[model samples]
Target: MSPSKQGKSQLIDSLYQKAKKLHWKQCEQCRVKKNLFKFVR
Candidate 1:
């Protein structure tokens, strides 16, 4: 994978881990991911 792709996935992974640690609901996680996607774009 390209560097950009790898970095994005890693960012998502870290966000996911943080959400899990905080015990966020699935919907909340989805929303966060969506916001992150917008920011990334």
Candidate 2:
């Protein structure tokens, strides 16, 4: 909700999309969401 948190999440989301484009074989969308969220926390 905070500005900094929003920025960090946006960055992570972009990284996720970039990874997706690169064909990160290990990253499924559902699983990656949880893992990335946990990684941020």
- What's the lDDT for all of these models? 0.92, 0.86
Which candidate number has the best TM-score?
1
Backbone clash pairs for candidate 2 read: none
Clashing pairs in 1: none
- 1-41 per-residue lDDT for model 1 (tens digits): 99999999999999999988777677788999999999999
Model 1 regions more than 4 Å off? 24-41
Give the range where candidate 1 is weakest over 10 consecutive residues by summed lDDT.
19-28
Stretches of candidate 2 off by over 4 Å are: 24-41
> Per-residue lDDT for 14 in model 1?
100
Worst 10 residues of 2 by lDDT: 21-30
- What is residue 9's positional error in candidate 1, in angstroms? 0.2
Tens-digit lDDT track of model 2 for 1-41: 99999999999999999888767655567688999999999
lDDT of 1 at 20: 89
